[model samples]
Target: MTQEYVYDYEPDYDQLMADIETLIQEGNLEGVRNLYETVHSVDIDEVLEDLDDSSLRYFLFMLEFEDISDLLENAEEDLQIRMMELYSTKELIEIFTFMANADVADLLGLLSTRRRKELLNYMKKSDSNILKMILSFDEESAGGVMTTEFISLKQSLSVREALLKIKDIAPETEIIESIFITDRQHRLQGIVDLREILVAPGYTPLSDLIEDMPFFIYAEDDQEEAANIIFKYDLKYLPVVNQKMAILGVITSDDIIEVMEQEHSEDILAMSGVSKDEEYDSTFASSVRSRLPWLLVNLVTAFMASAVVSLFEGTISQVVALAAAMPIVTGMGGNAGNQALSIVLTSIARGDMDLEDDWKLIVKEIVLGLFNGAVVGLFAGIILYMKYGNIILGLIIFASMIINMIIAGIVGFLLPLLFDHIDVDPAISSPIFLTTTTDIFGFFVFLGLASIVLPYLV
Candidate 1:
């Protein structure tokens, strides 16, 4: 159990942190190291995060460089910077050398350009160039997330030769469940499973064992796009390529799982109108930073809805009853709009729907809205009729409900698609726009009807 057991076992983290602190005070650094040996990287960072600056700086060098890399990878921005600052440039270079290139690149990405240059300069040219190239890619992209450590081979190699090659380099490669076979130019030909390589005759050519790749992505493509392909094809590893079809790296299934979770989180935040960049938001400021801008944008939409109501002030004042029923109409529309928007965004993200399917998709949502509105409106209208004993008012409420619901369906179906057409993220702004739309148009329909029927009611 090499001390990497995590929090799932309900370990008392407070007691552990206390022990580590006690050991540090007594000058028993070895005891502190043994206590943390069983701790997970996340748990290690959590304990480190609580330590005062002086204690943190002292304890960093107590742990091995490998453990240091783990903490740096999972730690918060401030903690990562602080930890790096405690180490000299030479020490930082040694620490980074112990990390995977992908992890090193990720940490470098958090630093300022000048600091990044200093660290990269300290590393060997080959490693420095690879990390630099990775840093050049957007962290949200396939190239950026991919680890450069992978097994690559020439098709000309026999199975025996490939096996010897894997034995020599397997420790250095990140994963070797499969080996990539490429041409002399390093253009990918196909992938072969380790299982297949082991069972085949030693004399068998590597080309004979090649499995057809379902798909490959460009390095610059979004990580979520790569995730979708890997999910759809059930691939364990997906190849990333450059424009020339030279294989850059493999995006493993683990990476895809992380990407999928991040994409899901983004969608959830988008629907809630929050822009999320952090998960370990421990402070009031972080919570406010995530939500305040979206709330401000939504305030503008609320004002638009309020303005729509103000336009009908005369009509609403005349039929004071309309004020009582206005919420019923807009509330139904907002709910319906959210339902359709969720479906659209999910389908678009999964590549299940495209612009070509727009007409049919729109027709289906609208029909669903109409059916739902008819049933709901009928009940509400009957209730209003029984209460007010005014057929005109009942009929007016009924018509308003149906019109608003249909309007909800239209905006829900069209807004996301429209955003996507303009190359914008469809999910991010749809909810705010959808709610405002339903409110504005719903008010117009209800108030306009009230104005028309005023003479009869009076």
Candidate 2:
């Protein structure tokens, strides 16, 4: 079997590429299928994505139903849709049945409405109903992201009976880390780990075997909250329930990891002023459209900063040195502010910061900003004093530096909070808004201070 060709049998890249080319050339369906069976599905998915459409279709048709299902589970959404289009209704239903409900819902969402309806009509009634139930929730909610195929046992059953029931149901369920215990009303009571079932006396009731009051998440809770609970408790799986304590489904740790990774990627894209769905293969026009709005916001803000500089044109012509040195103050303050803002925005996104704690964080940043400003400002003042031997010019730059830094820090801290209060993304606002504030204020402070102080020294 191809599984025998383990990681230790690493083929050289050129040899591996050559083998792929040969496989494409030979076009023997069975041989290509056997070759794919040797590698993990994730690796297969990557290889398939890299291949041109013809090679991908050839390799996909060679694989059996189980392998196709596994590969499709990890495939890109576009590829999944493409493959679904190729499969017959019966073949599609078989592969769809093998998928977890969360994955099914996601795949269905990516399909055209007409195709989605046609595919749903082909599914078993129970499977169709369950998929519809999952699809009803918002994609980011716990209900939407969870699997409905979790194992549940009645609290009255004996451990022996439970084991027999599990043997009957095991083939239908995937990743049975823990069995949920429910009451007559189907309200969740507790959880029994697989280890507990194995070790318990045959006559022990499930109520006795089940761990009392296990950790769980509400179905309406955000999916990230479910992920957080799993990560915090280091659980392999977590049960999802409704307000009445009736079990809904389970969120596997692997599923949570996927959600967290996607969320992190989306947040990074948002910070870069791109849409969440932006792809590397997207057309140039699409990429431009995604980034243009932010650039426009920045352009308007840039002109606003320039207007501040324009206000000081007289100050600029009088002292060319002020024009030369002003940007240094603003640039350093902007960098400092951006660094602080990035940390604060991350903390907010990760749910580490609370509404009440905003003041404490702001105060802490302001103090750090002042201390850093004082140190940097002192050095700047000494440099000016050495160069010009003018104490007024030195004092003017030092005072302006301190003022700009303090304002930059305030702008950084307050801008994120303001954005958060209005439900705007803080990361999107922090750099653009904070930099604008720092530049305009920095110019005004340095030039205004120089104007007031220049007569005394000159």
Candidate 3:
């Protein structure tokens, strides 16, 4: 009997594109606007990028300000700038008011300095002040990624009043997941979500409606840590606060996702010794500059490994078998070390493990390496024994494999922690350092064993 095959579903992108063109030809802005809202921002951004400036602007104006903000956030910088050029200062300011403060600041920073200043003058004072505050922080910090447009309510307000207040501000604020409760001095007290307010009696004070103190991060906290907080609590938005407990802004889950993706990409690139964020659209000269430092580092490490090989020059000259087997030992050990290192790096990044637990992870990996080494070494020793009928030669290869592999596992675990202690990125340095150590050690162990055990073979 034959089993039926089932396939996963797919969306019709060709049909969607055709429909978009049909709507455009009919000059139906409402149909285009509706279609834009239904699609994901990433797809909408791609479609918008394909349109001429005039058509893009027409679509942008037709969509709600919220939809336009979402599309702009996901689009490439060049595309966003092109879209911005079509809006007048006044029209841009109007739309800017509706955007979260961080989004507004980011867009402003992308414009020419003169244009930024001119646009600032045209924007509402509150909107301008919020953008200025967000812009003041480094682009990679929590402050730079937060929104100042969260709803805040006085502790004295009754549930009914707070509900009315939220309704009044809902149209103005970027996020309404939580209503922050503040005291007379505008100090943070507690927070309540919309559901809590809706369920409570109208006459009940906000203090009674409040939940326990909500999770918050300082404006100065690293943006990466802020992302971790969101993951820990499964929060929709985490609050940013001052030393005095005055609520400043909010870091939303959407922003956290973007930050995490960029950080992971940076780590992966750095692991290959490349400098951070090598732009895909960069010129060849720019790309070369970004990668040159890493290539030089690899060259230095390769020479160090070659120096280890030089130490065994006499053994290789005496025994052709030693030279033939050296690459297998070193290459396998290096590969094993890298696999263990990747697991440790990912665990650290996910906050599932840390330096404090290093010993436990090290022991576990070492045990795994020894188990693997025994199996691989046994196969290699048996093959050598069968081929050359030399028990001594087989013993040398088996002993060398076990020793080198065990060393590889321990060194791989320690190397990254050492780099982290020295204020360097461990992921960036560990691979190069571990690879060099494994190669040198593997050569030394294999050749030294051969020299001592099989003098006749050499």
Candidate 4:
């Protein structure tokens, strides 16, 4: 018996790669399998990078189809595309057989229309139809991310009967946690925890075990909406339904997690004045096309900020310190506004902030802005006083900082609300507008105060 190499989180990738290569060279394929038997699939994914095209293809055949399905799921998009190119349709179909419906849809989505159609043609009509239906949904909808395979028990079934049914179908099911209960019409009634079924007597009726599940969503609902549903109700999984209330599929925790991450990424991109398309499009033309519009918008706002500065040129000429100090006010204001914007945007996205209660949130943010400004402005003012040896200048800095912070807060809070009301995404348009507001006001207030106190400073 050969001793197995056991690794936990971090595996020695170089050794694994070398050992596998050396075994393959020595014609000990069985030894290669045994050597990697205890190795993690993720570690295998890393070692795969060292292999050339031919070797990589050969190495894939050594792994089980189930493992390949997982690898395909974990692999980067480019590599996944390459893997698709490397495999014949038959081989891909075999791998797809082991993959979840959602995973198959995702992979199929990456393929060209003609190529995807070709693969679909080879699938069983049942599987092909299911895949087509899932693919037909917008990539950001609940149906797009949901796995079509799930266990649905008849509400009238006994515990023993349900257990027998699950046993027969569990292998084909995505996961078993909260099993959905449905009527004879296939309309979902409720969901019962698997634990409840296990604890109940074998003869106990499923209807007695079922609990109310008023949290189901239409298949056409946004994936983010589905995610919100999960968060709002603390659900493990949400059932997707048709207008008839018949179950179409299930959105599991994994799907919710993906939706959240993608949404956050999209929001971050939008806030940063970047498009979501730019994230995946690395080509120079694609980069320019996706990013140029926002860059131009920012440039325009930047000039507006500069124009505000030009109005204070006389004060700036008299005291050069004003030139250096003015930016600190505007920069700090920009930072403050961004902070408020992030909170408001997240609240709006999650539907946590009620329309009726908007005033409470607005007042809270404004107060927070004033409190932060007073404390932070004091520190900034002290620093200015020490640097320039002028009390009036320090006081001006202090006052201006407070004023700009307040303005930043108001703009940040209202900008998103205004844009959302007007049917524009606050995430995409708010940042640019906030930059202009803070810059113009920040310069005006700071410079206006400096002009008034110019005689004392001189």
The lDDT leader among the candidates is 4
In the range 1-458, model 1's lDDT, one tens digit per residue, is: 22332344445778768766776677666665675576677776878888998888777767888778778888978799889888888888888877789888988887888989998888899999999888889999999889889998999999999999999999888988888889999999988999999999999999999987759999999998898888888887789899988898889888888788889999897788667574655477887888888899999999999998998888887778889888899999999998888888887887777776777777777788789888888888898888878788888878888888888998998888888888888878888899999999888898889888898765
lDDT of each: 0.84, 0.80, 0.80, 0.86
Superposed model 2: Cα runs more than 4 Å off: 1-18, 386-391, 456-458
Measured with C-alpha atoms, the lDDT of residue 350 in candidate 3 is 65
lDDT of 4 by residue, 37-156 (tens): 777666777777567787777777676777778778887676788778888888899999988888999999999999899999999999999999999888899989898889999999
lDDT of 2 at 160: 97
The per-prediction tally of clashing pairs is: 2, 0, 1, 0
lDDT of 2 at 442: 90
* Tens digit of per-residue lDDT, candidate 2, span 253-366: 888998889877877888778888889998899999999999999899899989988987877787777777888899988988888777777667666664566776677777
Stretches > 4 Å off in candidate 1: 1-8, 278-296, 386-391, 456-458
Error of 4 at 395 (Å): 1.9
TM-score of each: 0.92, 0.90, 0.86, 0.90
Give the Å error, residue 272, model 2. 2.1
TM-score for model 4?
A: 0.90
Error of 3 at 88 (Å): 3.6
Model 4: per-residue Cα lDDT at residue 119: 97
